[model samples]
Target: MFKAIADPTRRQILGILRGGRRTVGEIADNFEMSRPAVSKHLRLLRSAGLVVTRKDGTASLCDLNAKPLRTIQDWLQDYEAFWSDTLHSLKKHMEEGQ
Candidate 1:
C-alpha cells in the first residue's frame, strides 16, 4: 500500500475517485499524460486495494476503497499522540525554568 501511494500520480488518481465513481477516460482527462499512463497508475492503486474498478458496458469505472487508509490513519494517530505529549512536556519544562 505504501509503495502504491508513494507515487504522486497514484495519489492524484485516488483523489479523483473520492468524488465518486469515474470512468477511466474521465480520470485520464484530468492529466496531461496519455491514457495508458493514467491506466498504469490505476493498476497500481487497484493492487494496493485503494481503488476498485468495475466494467459498465464498455467503460471501466473506478471508485475509492478507503478501508486501507484507516490503517494509515491509526499509524499516524500514534505519532500525533507522541508529539502532543512531547510538546506538552517541553512547555512545562520551559515554564518551570522561568
Candidate 2:
C-alpha cells in the first residue's frame, strides 16, 4: 500500500481521482506519460486495494477505495498524538522564553 502511494505519479493520479472517478484515458491525459504507463500505475494501485475500477461502456471508471487508507489512518493515529504532544511542549517552552 505504501509502495503504491510512494510514486509521485501515483500520488498525483490518486489526488486527481479523489475528486471523482475518471476513465483511464482521462487520467492519462493529466500525465505526460503514455496510457500504458498510467494503466500500469493504476494496476498497482488496484492490486494494493487502494483503487477500484468498473467498466462503464467503453471506458473504465476508477475510484479510491477507503478501506486500506482507513487502516493506514488507524496506524498513524498513535504517532500523530505523540507528535502533537511533543510539538505542544516545544511551543510552550518557546513561548515562555519569548
- Which candidate ranks first by TM-score, i.e. highest? 1
| Model 2, C-alpha of 28: deviation from truth (Å) | 0.3
Deviation from truth (RMSD, Å), model 2: 2.2
Q: Write the per-residue lDDT of candidate 2 for residues 1-98, one digit (tens) a residue.
A: 99998999999988988899999999999988999999999999999998899999999999988689888889899899999999999999999999
Task: Residues 15-53, candidate 1: write the lDDT tens digits.
Answer: 888899999999999999999999989998998899999
Q: How far is candidate 1 from the true structure (C-alpha RMSD, Å)?
A: 1.2
RMSD of each candidate relative to the true structure: 1.2, 2.2
Angstrom error at residue 71, model 1: 0.8
Report the C-alpha displacement of residue 53, candidate 2, in angstroms. 0.9
Residue 17 shift from truth in candidate 2, angstroms = 1.3
- Residue 54, model 1: lDDT of 96
